[model samples]
Target: MNYLLIENDKCVGVCDYEPNVGNDNIQVITYSGNIPQERLIYVDGKVADMNNYTFINGKYVKKTKAIENLLNTNDEAKHYLNDTDWLVIRHRDQLALGQTTSLTNEQYLDLLTKRQAARERVVEYGE
Candidate 1:
């Protein structure tokens, strides 16, 4: 999900890079559409600017982000905030409704047994 990000002509930075083993600095990497190494800029521990990146119009931009911030969002700010307790059912029959998720081992087994029973039907014979 690496995107070529640019700030302007003054400075350019490629966030897409590999970390150097010893230094905190990111190794300026060259990939398809990557800026020339000499043209890239970095200051302190971060890429100070990102305006010189080469990109085309209408290209969807993306970036590789640290995983730390992924789970930091609250339920409301999150995209799909499902209730931890309620089961989501598409229909209303025994088989129509699905079990609430997060089942334990025993619960899962019980669900399987119930599912088997729900799928069965009584048969009658007439004289």
Candidate 2:
């Protein structure tokens, strides 16, 4: 049976075997053996309970669905932005001259309409 090793009321690691002889100085054989008794406070439940937590930084932290979703969303957004070529446009205002930058799809569409109107003016005036 699996056992969770607790240190200072926090789960530190997991062990496969519980000590056979004495409970006073119990030895838990984890992936990394010879964990000192000073760092080991107690042993928690079996494998079923251990599934609720993830081992991180020598401690078992509770895993949440929300945190997982947020992490996945961030990864997907990074990939999407990297793969896609976003449109860059310059602002038309005289005050913000000499600045060119990429814009989102909505901003690009707005600028596209203005550009089409300017093209129409050039065609009609021959300039």
Who wins the TM-score comparison?
2
Over 4 Å off, model 2: 1-27, 30-60, 85-127
What lDDT is reached at residue 75 by model 1?
23
Q: Estimated TM-score per prediction?
A: 0.18, 0.26
Query: Each candidate: RMSD to true structure?
Result: 18.8, 16.7
After superposition, candidate 1 runs with Cα above 4 Å error: 1-101, 122-127
Kindly list the per-residue Cα lDDT of model 1 for residues 41-108, writing each as its tens digit.
43333342233232224322222242122323322223222331132232223344555445555765
Model 1's alpha-carbon lDDT is: 0.36
Question: Against the unseen true structure, what C-alpha lDDT does each candidate score?
Answer: 0.36, 0.46
Task: State the lDDT of candidate 2 residue by residue for 54-127, as single tens digits.
Answer: 44456555559964555455556555444432333233432257444456557767756654544443311111
Clashing pairs in 1: 6-50, 6-51, 7-50, 7-51, 8-51
Model 2 clash pairs are none
Residue 74 C-alpha lDDT in model 1: 26
